[model samples]
Target: MRDRRGQGAEPDAARPTERAPSVRSEGAPAPPERAEAVLPEGVEAPPAADLAALFLLLANSALFHLGEGPDAMGEAAPVDFAQAQFSIDLLRLLREKTEGHRSPEERRLLDGIL
Candidate 1:
């Protein structure tokens, strides 16, 4: 009697299964290598100390009007004493907010900056 499923419906155990085609071509070129980042002239990547120092410098510039030089386009900016005081106050707030979370060294540095 004929099978009820239909003729040739059963998977042939002797035949090899077909595979999907590869996505990459065999002759494709290798991917390009990544290069190191280039920083601006006289500027190195910032370290942890540099970040703290940056805030200090900004506060000093506000408080003492230092580092007020001509811009890249030769334009000079007027110093705002009020803005500097605000930055100093913000730094104070940061110290208070981060109070128990900082390491001894970090706390010392922050305290010195403040």
Candidate 2:
């Protein structure tokens, strides 16, 4: 039978299948690339550019200052409404700046966080 391109099936079967190389061999676990690439001790990892992660971080910070969550250090600090307000304002600014650019999921997440 001829394919849509008018090529015979036998001719196509004789051609080698082209595919990208696999990163790992069969039955082998994936290499720990991220783990092996370590930085000097006490050095912080590079800042992430993920909008969702940033949003969650800001939300958590705000909640922590507002006494609704624990600090990054896991300590319960006194409530600071002013600081919380500032964080929330920052989130609002992000929403404004990212208007018409965010995916539906991102918009929904931001709205829910707000």
Candidate 3:
């Protein structure tokens, strides 16, 4: 058959099937999907420049030190009250220093975290 470029073309049956490229490197198995990777309908990703996200990140660090979060091996680490207190203090100082520079929602979130 003649292709659009007026060149001879292989018969359809003789051509190899095409596929979408794999996201990973060649020969690598596809990564498994984790429930945390997907957001529920109508939910949106956190904004890149969000102050609320920064507040939440520090809060989570405190929670981790308090042994409420998993460790590197996904096991609960021993509670370290000092570290936890430090994290909370840092978060508080950040909120205070950024006063009047945050949106109403960001201020509310920071207050709630404290």
Candidate 4:
């Protein structure tokens, strides 16, 4: 390799090093905090963190399998009857299992999906 010293490249010892900000006082690594979420432009954020979100997520999966949702290429996925049925069944199970515990709006959202 050609000499890099003459090209203004610093030796490793001359470069300043940075300590990672997340270390603990005892020198063991600190537990990570939940990082802020970032999303691509035009993509919707995930649903609110609740049962409604679960319901919506499962419902979305069902729709995706049914070819009603976008694929990785942003086009509608091909129909997958078995997978679609499985997703629907999962949604139904969640609905039944959470019967009385669901909020009014959640019940309506799930019911609408079904």
| Candidates' RMSD to native | 16.0, 15.4, 15.1, 10.0
Clash count for each candidate, listed in order shown: 0, 0, 0, 0
Q: Pick by lDDT: which candidate is best?
A: 2
3 or 4, which is superior by lDDT?
A: 4
Candidate 1 lDDT over 1-114, as tens digits, reads 867543365657745779865675778776687565689999887554554665576566665543366545776756666776777788788788878977777678878777
Per TM-score, the best of the predicted structures is 4
Please write out the lDDT profile of model 4 over residues 18-40, one tens digit for every residue.
98765467867667987868999
Which residue pairs in model 1 clash with each other?
Answer: none
What is the TM-score of candidate 4? 0.57
Greater lDDT among 1 and 4 belongs to 4
TM-score of each: 0.42, 0.55, 0.56, 0.57
Lowest lDDT 10-residue stretch of candidate 3: 2-11
lDDT of each: 0.67, 0.86, 0.83, 0.84
The positional error of residue 59 in candidate 3, measured at the CA in angstroms, is 0.2
lDDT of 2 at 58: 90
